[model samples]
Target: MYASYKNLKIEVKFQGQHVAKSPYILKGPVYHENCDCPLEDSAAWLREMNCPETITQIQRDLAHFPTVDPEKIAAEIPKRFGQRQSLCHYTLKDNKVYIKTHGEHVGFRIFMDAILLSLTRKVKMPDVEFFVNLGDWPLEKKKSSSHIHPIFSWCGSTDSKDIVMPTYDLTDSVLETMGRVSLDMMSVQANTGPPWESKNSTAVWRGRDSRKERLELVKLSRKHPELIDAAFTNFFFFKHDESLYGPLVKHISFFDFFKHKYQINVDGTVAAYRLPYLLVGDSVVLKQDSIYYEHFYNELQPWKHYIPVKSNLSDLLEKLQWAKDHDEEAKKIAKTGQEFARNNLMGDDIFCYYFKLFQEYASLQVSEPQIREGMKRVEPQTEDDLFPCTCHRKKVTRADLLTHVRTKDEL
Candidate 1:
């Protein structure tokens, strides 16, 4: 017999407490807003503006072009264009750590892993410490403030004094990585036993304290249309599941909730189930089959079925060839991804991104000796200096530092 939406279930447990229960129903017709369409259009425009032949001809004619003062050109560009001010701020002493993760659903794990790798491989700031959300950390382990820092839950307020800089939101990469990781972790639990049993799986709402906060989210959604889609999908899925239990009593870590709510079987098999339809459109339809069956399946073979079947290797090869034919466009896309990674994930970016706010905490003026010592301790390289601001005992503007170096050279 074909499985019905009634067959799907999820259980919610927050801080060892069960608050509510609901059914998991796969609603028809999921829709995704075409966010990339505009980006694609923009790329096409750039291609038209700077065709390869045009670029080549321009390069050849460069010798005959009139020279202009770069400084004059720089001065001409407005610091703030129209009403859009720079969202980012830079200062000499601000010490902020911005975190980003990758992937749509399952990409958060990849992002975290990447961040961890960056932390270990990249340079470490002397006075600055690293942190991930408390809810994201392993539940079995206790957090040590002395060793590493921790961010409070999204719903909780943190002391501005304790934090040198404001936390930038998680990147799409991080969210996607988390989604994949959650699926993988849940899949393992489902195969192993009773706790991991599919019958017991559930989703719950735990973040906000009252309807007012929830309403505020709705208000915010108006200004940021992306939130309308993303947040609505999340809540709708939580509400639709019947076998699923709780919008748990309080907020809980995904790890702990998974561990306590389900049991692992002795044979290494996990119980699997689908979540409810959260979004109102057809996009969810495309994801429906695998979202439940394939995502939770333990065996690799069943999972393969969830993946769309390719008619033949040759057909796939043809698509790859077509991509290669548009090498310049492909290169641009690759460069964009690399730049995204560098701007959002690199160390210096993280620092400068937060430093603007962090500088406000300083009461005493920072001196050159202190800056030199801090620089010596961190020894930041180009890769490590991805952030906008540099960390010294005192913050120094990048422009000022460059001018000083140039002055020394002239001497």
Candidate 2:
């Protein structure tokens, strides 16, 4: 049998307090939020703070009040939101709110949950309606079967064969709601700034192989080509200051004339072969055994940078062959290699996107009536604010105390 359409409006109540007010009926008394805290903390915080004693009492009193079971709520949020969409909510405690659909494509579930939470907390009796655009096969079928019914904006074209509709793009009203919720969440999370925000550029590059060894080798080649070549070849030659036949030119077949004419060979080996040198300024310099391509190329003149040097031919062929044989391995290593710096750190962009979405969602306008109703239903309790708690205390505040104690004790 199809689920009854009692105009499903979920009212999220905290503790026993009615936090949200709307005509739409809510499913349960529990709510869920995405947070940085571990499962234990998340569970404990919600059980203790979000569902305070007072709010729990009110939840019991209401016949249609929604319940917030942590595990069940967590399963309802979406993993990602649209570019214009945000994930923020005005939850009772400092926790994240995540909502998604049930049974079918729950991609937007967490976002929807956040929207609901925000509406209750920020907006006052908002005439909001939830909607899903049926443009995909599964979704369209689900909608057709009455598995997922439209709660808002019933006007849609039936001729369109798409499973999801173009109108699925987050509307301005939704975005506005998200913006308000995001601000509230941000206020609770606090601005510690980015993990790499306080670090200097040099510090950021300190341990990076690209910055240290590769860059140093390039600079060394530019400054003293002959010295570098001599070191690599275990032979000393007269340092020449001409740009025409760089240390590298001796190895290339195109520059064979110059090599033979100058007798620029060490023992039986060609000078370029004996010593792998990249051209720097007007001459060629010794090459270092660094693993980055950019650093190796940057040492050469811009016009000649792409030109193949005899010294690197063997290495290039080896790398190319290896890449062909083990493409996945090469990709894995490349990704791993990128993790040494803040700029190329893994998941940086994704986290930034999440942060931005959080900000936008926090700024949404939750209905004031809902929040007031929730507040009115729940009684206030004298819980410990714990300004002196170790986890919540500030070092600066302690320093002030130390100064006062030291001076007062001395007096």
Candidate 3:
């Protein structure tokens, strides 16, 4: 899995076509003089992009999950737990996915299916049974007996033991709407509005009142309308005091977010799933720092990829002013962040992360996974199988367009 090369040519091919600069020669850490400079020159990028860090991250995330002698952690997976949590058990065996514990969360299942389906097409997946937490927060409580049990979730915290996986919203567009929503991974990237300079000068945000900081963000926007334009599209937590939070604003298109030069990413229940979309867009992301994080968050740098803001929003006003004063620097950060996402967060990278995550998890188990009684088998939904995605401009069939359009051979 680790490589030490001397004069190696790294050619990247996508969909039967050679990527623009194919065969990037690699001689140890540095490539040939006229190589893919920034990407190839940086040892971290090469190591991370190639999947070692991803594997290591998976190991670290699951470190607290207890391992038994001979390790048979797969069979030891508990059928019942004392604490009530939204979780579903799954087993990937014989190139098919089987569900042990049923979950009604379609969004989460859609994302998991995409990962398993993508992997099944490319490689024979080893039999592994794991639990997926459907809740917003990680199931592993601090200093609880849950540490002995492995649980996978969209987000994780330093104090928790849940293995962080990619958030479901990435591919949840395939749900009830029949892929009509722009929230899906492909459309989110493709429909990011105009360039940075062309966008509005103000920073914009719109979300439900899930977190108190979000409500405060809207209040801050009212006082400083010029620098910030934040509002709650829906109010739930503070419903009794809705009058103080202003009228509930109608939901806007995700593409409309890029109209502003800055995008505010405040976590709702856990780590906001919109961070990835914000990073992919042309505008700079003013991300709120929090304990919760997605799998790729560790790779992001503050002020380099995004302008980090205090979790409490106490210094948000100051951060906004600094961004306004340092327009060009802010623009560069936005560009850097966008480039990072465009390159590293491609469909292939996501699939690679999932493959390695489960692969490593499978390796740790000594028991041969089996399909539990009453478990239902889930099938992979290929491009042809997906419903036609209705776009704003036109109704487009998933088959007619590229939706995470990578082949197993490519992976």
Candidate 4:
């Protein structure tokens, strides 16, 4: 049984509390709203959209882009990544740090690690004293779950008690993260030349229909073809359900992100996970004001790093027109955004933010356990007990990331 195994386990611990260790199941990214396909079927469908080859020379030489097995790697992802959770306001009255999540939901590993990495900084901090699962799940959503909201700053979203910690991809959170840019691959595709040298003048966006805003964007793109170049990214999901999407559902290469002068960044289920990469690129980021946030959103300024659009995207065309007329300013904003991302959003920077955020949050909790009235503890199950699906990425906090120890240790 052990003959074929490579990396055996991934246990994540933070301040003496079991954040999550792996051998856990993941549900994969196959949500068709009205269809229930087999695990292989869903994984096969998702594989079409995957980046099979690594962009960097090192990753290519080492053959490190796609994992040997998605499900196996997914098994080690912590429980905080993908599933839904009870969102909350994080009032001073609440006494426990409750993480009610699904291991299979998407991006669980990165989500968990961000929180776990932070607590490792100091030992005096308090850990999760009690696991609260009220008779009913009450923390599923928040009335004010904006990007990096003031209340419960360490949590991922007010909608989910996920690790809203510092990630290069806070909006960079969700992705086919298995073989994408991690902290280990240092040669990020930053916009080296000026934006004036870019080929495409119009704004572009190529992602899936994770949120209603993306659909609206596709519609806007259709109406204003000259200014927008947006498209849906699902091949199989839209083949069955094309009612909400436009005619185009194309596959975008990683290099394609730098092809244009302007890049449109929109929120998916929450914040757009790919925003940081876009900001780091040569193109100006045309962002939408969303309730969903990330760890560094508070630090980013509008017009300085990116052009802010209405949450409704009502002013996208106007913003584009302004950028086109004011080419110098657009280029400057893009350059500034890239600089900010390079200096502030690096892997080490992200880890430091997580540590500081964790320390600050831990300082606030100072009382006996006040378990919620209805909450009950739920144990986690791995892929063996429940069929697993999905991925893993490199941790940014580590210094010697390129040397793969190749043991059943952390990935």
Candidate 5:
């Protein structure tokens, strides 16, 4: 009925015949290092499940700001950003999602719809409308300003006021690869290869020159060849200084990152999207200390889930050396981090966070949401249906049905 140590596969049969869905798989709920508590223990469940804490965490993420005013956000965003291409206005009313945007943002729209659909399958989706910015940079207020614009975003810095939401790439892969390939967070976890004992001892990093510290990481690798092996796979921001940064390397599969024992996570434009994927792997993550943070960042504790390095990567070699000096302890940290991610960052958790976030956000609404003019309803598509609404395809209308009926009667 339940997994004792790890995931188990059980085959069910009725009188020597396989039953429907017979080969059922069971996964063990995440537990502490030496937890021998009963499977149905309420305290242990709350400690590991993270479902009950979702609302409290959402409240913590929004506590610094004033009460969220959806009407205020819907009115101020367009005037401030001028209907930017990466900005979208969303409204969830009567279990249907609607959007109003200036540009064709098919990917972000699809990501939002997919998550909402998944959430609706598990719980009643709360009615809420707010603005979201799909850009890499978070919003910054004026130096002496005094206003709270609750614009949702994927990432935010310490000084920013934008409300941080789970990144879209967690559900849809389009944002993960910058529109190149389709691979979600679960896919990344599946591809993380080799156990910790089988990986290379060197700390590994492969990324663009989006941040200057990344370039310095490569230089540090050159000095401490035994400890680190960082390189710029692509050089966009510092293309002119490519010669100084060393030759570019070919892009490798995300699975290749797990080949090393230590993973180096440095920020790009904001909080790097790769950090979540990195945390889920078997290798110990050496994260950079920066102002930018994702939604689940507050829960990550250094020396437990990850090792923290200075923002400028000043103590990277020292941290890597420490990991080498205490190999077993480092491996335990890796396992702890991996278990934490497995328990909290799953698709179900994402849906739970979204549902609770909107639920709390809707409760603070001062005015009932209205479907604004020019807003188009977004619905999921199906191949079996004769008429299905999709992101790329338009839905059949009542006017078209009336015209078809009249033509049939005349014929």
Candidate 6:
């Protein structure tokens, strides 16, 4: 059933617009100032601090697999954030999240759960919506207001003051990890010889001219064509920088990435979403340093898993030459990166990371009305009593702490 709150009035309805709309959402909570809803502005801060979109995810997952409880933990709202008994809790069948923003965003919204794997409506939005930021080519100009919640984009700085959910891509779900990236890695590795053996010695990079650093990388390719093979995937996106990106190629499939010896991983938008997949391959990834990083980046080492390039790529050609000259060392780095992804960065890691992060946030939830008390209740719609099949509670317990501290194995 649709999540309709008595308090939430569905302000507007768009007909056939999801087809026209772009799918990518941004890094932080987005607020729609144009939507003059009554209850939205007052509860805006809580929306920023928590991932209410997770409720949609939980509902969808429970609809499919009824066995998974996903370990719930409760917290009182922190004094720094609020003092009210306004509990910012995440539970199955019982989540009380005010949908911060709603639109035809694909890549950027909350994981809501693995439900994106099943449902067409990406979000069954709460009436109380937040901002809807368009993180496109040119950054949106910051509005002149004190309550500024700038989107933390993939290409955005990680140090921004805006409150955001634990930074992650929706692909972190098991569906993409096993069905998409992992399968692609396996197929590519199986079809091709090792990076040191049959791969081309030239440094290869394929992506849109989304960022200046990427355009510059393509420019470097012209100077040393023998060593670098760089091209734009869509030069059409280039209006002002057409001359610089004119020579770039149209597109490269994900499977074709393994054909090269050195795969140049650069930042796009905010972080390189492909880097995680690239690291799983045999190719030596020459990654450029950037302020933006994904959820799992801290677990990786620059020179250990993949070679780090300078921010400006001043040594791009030199780095390519060194890899060509020292093929074995480059292969070693490639092998290490593959192993790191295989052993550490799995679908389980994504679940656990979000699990822990949510647990911490739950602990600070305001504890007044408690679970269902004082809160408005719906008939609790679903095909079955599937949501949060186990372990949702009105009070904190020791079991919550144990789950929080333990790793996947411990859990």
Best by TM-score: 5
Better of 1 and 5 by lDDT: 5
- Whichever of 2 and 4 has more lDDT, that candidate is 4
Q: What lDDT score belongs to each candidate, Candidate 1 first?
A: 0.25, 0.25, 0.71, 0.51, 0.72, 0.50
| CA RMSD of each candidate after superposition | 25.0, 26.2, 11.1, 17.7, 9.8, 17.6
Tens digit per residue, CA lDDT, model 1, 1-411: 111122334556677765575334434221111111111232343343332222221222122223322222222212322122111111122221233221223232333333333332222222222222322211112233322212211111111101212122232222233343343322322332232223222222223212233333334334444212112223333354312322334334433333222111110011111211111100111111121121112222211212121322122223333433554443343233323333333333333322221122222223211222112122222311111222222357788588656656766
RMSD of 6: 17.6
lDDT of 6 by residue, 206-317 (tens): 8886778888888898888998888886754466887756754667666676788889988876777777668887889998888765545655788789888998899888
Count of backbone clashes for each model? Answer: 75, 71, 1, 26, 0, 28
For each candidate, what TM-score against the reference? 0.19, 0.18, 0.75, 0.54, 0.77, 0.56
Q: Compose the digit string of candidate 4's lDDT tens values, residues 1-411.
A: 201122444355677666755435434333221111223332332244342222222222112112122122123222332244322211112212333333233243344433342222111223332121211211324344332112132324434433345443441332212234341213345333334664688788998877677778888988989889888876343455466565656586655767788888887766776777788777899999976666567668999999999988989999999999999999899889988987766644554444344333444344433333333332222223122222122233343333223221443
Residue 111 in candidate 2 has what lDDT?
A: 38
Question: Any idea what lDDT model 6 has?
Answer: 0.50
Candidate 3 lDDT by residue in tens digits, 112-228: 766566455445566788878777888666586553677788889867878988777653442312334646555666677877678898989999999989988998999999889
Taking all chains together, the TM-score of candidate 4 against the true structure is 0.54
The true-versus-predicted C-alpha distance at residue 368 of model 1, in Å, is 26
Which regions of candidate 1 fall more than 4 Å away from where they truly are? Answer: 1-78, 81-86, 89-195, 209-249, 256-411
Specify the poorest-scoring 10-residue window by lDDT in model 2: 199-208
After TM-score superposition, what is the CA distance of residue 233 in candidate 3 from its true location, in Å? 1.2
Ten residues in sequence with the least summed lDDT for candidate 6: 384-393
As for model 5, its CA RMSD to the true structure in angstroms is: 9.8
Clashing pairs in 5: none
> TM-score-based ranking, best first?
5, 3, 6, 4, 1, 2
